[model samples]
Target: MPVTSAALLLHHGRGADAHVLIAHMGGPFWARKDERAWSIPKGVVEPGEDVEAAARREFAEELGVPAPDLPVRDLGPFRYTSGKVVHVLAVEVPAALVGSPDDPASPDLTTRPGTSTAQVEWPPRSGRRIDVPEVDRAVWFALPRARPLLVLGQQPVLDALVAATTP
Candidate 1:
């Protein structure tokens, strides 16, 4: 069975985007084009890899940052248009603990070209390269603002995450 795991990436924003939480991603197979790309840190669990363990590993390898100690609430799984089953999980992280993978210590950072640091070759024919952990930046975005930025398949997880954090 083909299965994947990912993170509900988040960051802290004090100014206008404060209450807003954001996720990180590169983009889909076709729509990718700088900033238009979005994603949560995710990857396929290797055989015998535990679910939570896969989530944590994907987060670190994809984001190039250590996984937070936040509690992960299993948000269940969802199917993608590709017919692949993706397991989702949510975690609430303090805004302060969040930072770009390139500058893992820089809180006011954005844009990390090779920060995603993971790669996957794509197109059964072209064999072009695609990066795994496909995000270069991650930031918190307020409600409604995040709608257009999230990957098509992962938005529901974000909604569930918002509900989980609210009230």
Candidate 2:
């Protein structure tokens, strides 16, 4: 059976050029990569857990806060090149929640990078225990701009957003 994941496509506006939230992939393998590396906050669906609940849980685990109490619209699912299906939700969060670079409370900018730890072995087989962040940081970008920044397989997820919300 193919694996399925849940993702959050947070936006702040409607139609084209909508600002979307993204997180940089963490851990060593992705550390030096940039283009086509970032991704939506998402995780695999666990047995018996509601997909939406799993999505919310993943977002909190990665971002260090509960997802804002906003209505979430299902954008449906897509299969990526890796052959995994991902169910995504489109959420429109207020700018205040993800404030500007000049704002003191901005989790994406004005403040320090958000950190979530994962235990891994350094040097692969060396068995040295090391803790690395689950995500290096997060930022918001317009859909077009986010395209080049998003993981290649997830581009369709953004396209779905544009098509669904455009008038």
Candidate 3:
């Protein structure tokens, strides 16, 4: 059986004009890479657990906040080159939770980011544990802008999200 993972895709706006929230993966290996390195807030589904619940838990673990209690829709069991079957739930981040998109300094992103920090031993055995943010940062991007930056494997979720809201 392929490894299964669950993710949450938080989007906002109407129809074709939506923007989705995504995160940059953490750790030294991903530090310098930008294109094709970021990922949705997600994780492996443990035995017998509900996929949506797991997605919510992973969101909280990765971003440090409970996912807003809202209606969620399935995007896909998008299969990746790595053989991970990613099941995703998407919901529009309520307008009440966001600030103006033009203001980069605004703190009202639908979901707050970066509390599930991780620790790693850098230099491959230097014995120094370095703490890093699991999801170093997050951004809300329109599909055009996000397609180029997201991990290729997960792009289908974006397409599905757009399709779901499109007329």
Candidate 4:
């Protein structure tokens, strides 16, 4: 079976004013990149884990903060061209949880210091290894503004969010 993952798309507001939380992928490869360098908080679904539970767990792990206890709208599963299937769920978070789109420096969306980390071969095949945070920082961006910044494979997940919340 293809690998399955789950994500939680955290958004605030509605319509054109809506903003979603996205993390800047950590490590050297993504450090200097902006476009297509951000992603929804997600991870693989462990064996026998409930999809929703996995999404929530991944959100907390990646952000280093527990997700708010709120109802979520299922955005369903999206299969990327690489054959990875990601189950996405979205919740409208409190306005206070998201930083102002006009103020990138606002601390509202900052991740805690103890966020999850991953080990990788620093030079890609080199003998050196380094541990880096899974996501260095997270912020809020308007829906349209977030499109170009997201990983191509996950752009569809954003689309699903738009459709589900459009009404």
* Model 2: lowest-lDDT 10 consecutive positions: 101-110
Model 3 accuracy (lDDT, Cα): 0.79
Per-residue lDDT tens digits for candidate 3, residues 14-90, read: 56688878888877868899899778889999999999999999987877777778889888799999887999999
Q: Write the per-residue lDDT of candidate 4 for residues 14-132, one digit (tens) a residue.
A: 65577898888888888799999998999999999998899999988887877778899999998888899989888887787544333222232334654788998998989899988
lDDT of 1 by residue, 1-167 (tens): 55565544443432333343444554445335534355566778788888778877876655556667667777778677877766877665566554434334322223443344445666646778765545545555564666666667766765666555555
Whole-model lDDT values for every prediction: 0.57, 0.78, 0.79, 0.82
Ranking by TM-score: 4, 2, 3, 1
Candidate 3 error regions (>4 Å): 100-114, 118-121, 124-131
Q: Residue by residue across 42-82, what tens digits does model 2's lDDT show?
A: 99899988888988888877776667667898999888877
Top-lDDT structure, candidate number: 4
Error of 3 at 101 (Å): 14
Determine the C-alpha RMSD for candidate 4 after optimal superposition of all C-alphas.
3.3
Total backbone collisions for each predicted model? 9, 0, 0, 0
- List clashing residue pairs in candidate 3: none
Report the Cα RMSD per candidate. Answer: 5.1, 3.3, 4.0, 3.3
Query: Which residue pairs clash in candidate 2?
Result: none
